[model samples]
Target: GPQGPRHLRPLLDTVLDALHTGTHARGGPLPTGGPDTVTAAVHDAAGDLLPDRGDPDALRTLVHAFAAGAADPAHPLCAAHLHCPPLAVAAAADLAASALNPSLDSWDQAPAASALETLLTRTLARETGHTDGLVTTGGTEANQLALLLARETHGTVRLVHGANAHHSLPRAAWLLGLPDPVVVPAPAGTLDPVALDDALTRLPGPRGSVLVAATAGTTDTGLIDPLPDIAARCTAHGARLHIDAAYGGALLFSDHHRAKLTGLDAAHTITLDLHKLGWQPVPAGLLTVRDAHDLAALHHRTDYLNADDDTEAGLPDLLGRSLRTTRRPDVLKLAVTLKTLGRTGLGALVDQVCAHAREFADLVHDDPRFHLHDRPAISTVLFRPAHAPDPAVAAVRRHLLTTGRAVLGRARADGRLWLKATLLNPATRPDDLRALLTLVHRTHAEGPR
Candidate 1:
């Protein structure tokens, strides 16, 4: 066990060198020739799935193949999803987390990690005007937990959400065995407060029997709902509110953009994901509760992990913390990132990415070759090649993907398909934006290859 660190040092060098070699081989945002080709290459690199005796070079070989095949979000052209390029410092901390392999399920297994989690979650909860919170796998789990908590509070509460809400919300309702959700119209690409109020009034449920889920940022177009009005409607209707700020929650870090989340504090539970904008690795999500008492719904029991006797004996109860038993000390990387960057540094990155979106939107607006869907509400810009049929637009995105030219997302807004660019990489430059659009325009002009 003591030799673990020494053993890791040289292996890390090989991994880093392999990653660099793979990126060089890739020569673009992602590997060329699409899925089949990438799969074949990976299979070759992997050699045998399992061997009687392991190859010493397996780590370096696999890591190289992994990097080469990955759709690197750090690349300037890889502006597809809410996926973000993680901060270097955060990734470094993640390595240590993996090495120690602390399980948060028991205080004995992860004493310092447990304490760090408690301190971090509480501090982050206060940022959202909450009393306490839980660490989730991501927005999906957070949404599921929010629904779980709501259901526990009010027996079989109906889920009422906007059409703009993420698919996870309705799916979570289904998984929890709740009634089919009532979806209000998002005609303007956001939850229409009036429509939400109407739905709330018409729904046949007791005052506290409805849980209204609203989106702070819609996935397709990145449009934020009118949260203040939605919160007011929830208050008046006596319905509980859970705002999914997975995409826009990081705006809270920015003084300029934090005002956009004026009604965030009103939600009974709030889902905030950092992987999208916090420059952290995947699975960084939190669900904050306005009242710490709400977390009682998740209180769990087990003899080995968090025994009653152990809890009473001043050892912290860890079973009530999560839905999973063997979760990592994910808080470690987050804590490192927050401690290193603080609020202002992280906010500056947010501001820069938002600005990049605006600049890209401008490029699309000024070019007759493309049509800007709308000015970006956050850091997502939607634009389409001018007068291109929806099929052609879809074809253009696929062409770029297959050819490994660029990575861009597609969305349906205003009954038309538009190219979606979610600019989460703050390092992206204006020239890169122009090149991305040029790739789309050129592909559309040349037709699908």
Candidate 2:
């Protein structure tokens, strides 16, 4: 067991070297020649997967290919989706987690990790004004769990979510076999309080028969639902509230922007994802519950793992913490990151990224060649080449993708397609934003080559 480092240290060097060489070889945000070319490169490098004899240099070869083809989020030009370049320390901690390979299904398998997770997750939960929380794979799992718990509390509940809500919420409801959800308008990009209140009142059901899903950070445009108004309506209409704050939840760390999420605590459940704003590696998500008693639904016992005698003898039962069995210790990286940065350090990072978005938006506004969407609610800025047809807007994005010049996303808002730049990199500078705009302008001018 202790000899793991001795064997892993050299392999670490090999991996690091491959990553360095690969990023340079890529030379841009993503690999050139687009998906087909990237596919060919991977096939060539992969060779035979199930060879009779194990290939000794497989690690080095594969790591290089993977990194070379990856759309690097750390690059200033790669501003797309909600992907963030993970912090170095968090990634390093993940390496240790992998080497140890502790599964969280039972305490006996991961005693120390189990204890550590309980402490870390509760502390995170309290930040959301909730009594307890569960570590989840990400936002999707957390959202699903929220719906499941609601259904358990009240049989056959209905989901009422804003049109701006994350797609996962309705999907989770449908997966749980709940009634079809009612959709409210988000005409101004944020959920309308009037529409939500009307929907809740019109739906004929007992109190707590409907679950209202609001969003703090939307996937398409990064807009937030009106939490206070939504929560108040839920209270009045006798409905439960679940806020999917997967994107905006990290604002709690930032003193500057936390005010935007003022009524967050009013919800019965809240979803938080650290991988988006906490700079952690993937699979870092948490769901908080206002009532700890709600978690009793998850309690399950299997004699081989979490035995009854083991629990009575002071062994902690880990089965009640999640819906999944055989989970990896994804908490290690999250713990390492939260401990390293604390509130001020993490808040500073949040502030910087938000500032970067505003700066880029201002740049777009000043230039006559581009049309800027409303200012960023979080760190997402939407803009399009001024007077360009929607087809040209789509083509410009593809042109950048094929040439490997930059990586940007597209979102449909206000009945038009706009190029989306989600600035999550704290290392981004003023020059980087300028350069990004310049690339977009030049690409549009090149006429879809």
Residue pairs in collision within model 2: none
Per-residue C-alpha lDDT of model 1 across residues 1-449, encoded as one tens digit per residue: 79999999998999999999999889999899999999999999998879999898898889989998999999999999999999999999999999999999999999999999999999899999998999988999999999999999888999999888999999999999999999999998998889888998898878779999999888988888999999999999999999999999999999999999999999999999999989999879999999889888879998988889989999998888898999999999999999999999999999999999999999999999999999999999999989889999999999899888899999988899988999999999899998998888888999866
Off by over 4 Å in 1: none
Error of 2 at 269 (Å): 0.8
Residues 292-336 of candidate 2 have per-residue lDDT tens digits of 999988999999888999899998898989999988999899888
TM-score of 1: 0.99
Model 2 score (lDDT): 0.93
